[model samples]
Target: MPDLAYYASLPRTRGAAAALLLDDLGRVLLVKPTYKQGWFLPGGVIEAGESPLTACVRECQEELGLTPRLTGLVCVDWAPPRDGVDAVNVFVFGGSITAAEIAAVRLPPEELSDHVMAAPEKVPELAPAHIARRMGPSLRGLAEGRALYLEDGRETPFG
Candidate 1:
């Protein structure tokens, strides 16, 4: 195994996000962020002293306004820091929601402006570099109910 500590030393702390996978007739749910205008899964950082699982669930509810059935954690991505920022560890949880319930979800104005559903093959056009890399693999593992290990130091899986 690679030296996880080498990468861990680059960032002082970890930030978490939930990659909410809403399976819609073989399609997945994604959001186009207002600030960045790129495709991304629904999730946000874990608050101070908050559990990753709790934060994942809360973020989905707050951002999308839908209570999804969180199946399991599909992937863990480490994004090394650029400039003086901290590295990010995004915990993508596999989940499911209904198409009818999709319309009921609401996006926070500061975080996002709109949402869309796309086949996995079309994900590259919408996702940020970090996220785009893992979208397909993560979705596959999530669908299969297996955890995908993304412990690569050279690759970034979330932006």
Candidate 2:
């Protein structure tokens, strides 16, 4: 368990986001937070009374300048150890948009610097630490499909 005292003292924030995974064929969507200046999946804090899915769609429009139909919830992560903040819950949804659409996107400096599709192996360089960690197993699961989910986010040791 984390330090509840510190967590309770800090303000809680709710956010929604989507992860657009594309191949190195020059495609994918990611955002750079102005406060942290790190490459992260596109999405932002949910508005005071917005649904998570709605917020995710809105964030994709605002950050990537494209409308994405979220296909599935890939991962829900709880990030820790950022200043006094208790946790940052990240909701990752799988979706796709045309490369032509991404080319037309104009990102504001506050949200994203640029969006590009890169090779899956290169993701570690672009993804934030917490995000990268969460993605590691998820990607494997994506490749393995239902067989992977049978364990529910666990890793089996290799001989």
Best by TM-score: 1
TM-score, every prediction: 0.82, 0.71
lDDT of 2 by residue, 68-143 (tens): 7555665555555466755555666666666666678778786556666656667678776565665555555434
Model 2 TM-score is 0.71
RMSD of each: 6.0, 6.5
Give stretches of model 2 more than 4 Å off.
Answer: 1-13, 23-27, 140-159
What ranges in model 1 sit over 4 Å off? 1-11, 152-159
Q: Whole-model lDDT, candidate 2? A: 0.61
lDDT string, candidate 1, 66-131, tens digits: 767888988777766754857877788888878777878788888889888888888877776667
For candidate 2, the 10 contiguous residues with the lowest summed lDDT are 145-154
Cα-based lDDT at residue 111, candidate 2: 53
Q: Using lDDT as the measure, which candidate wins?
A: 1
Clashing pairs in 2: 27-117
Clashes of each: 3, 1
State model 1's lDDT: 0.76
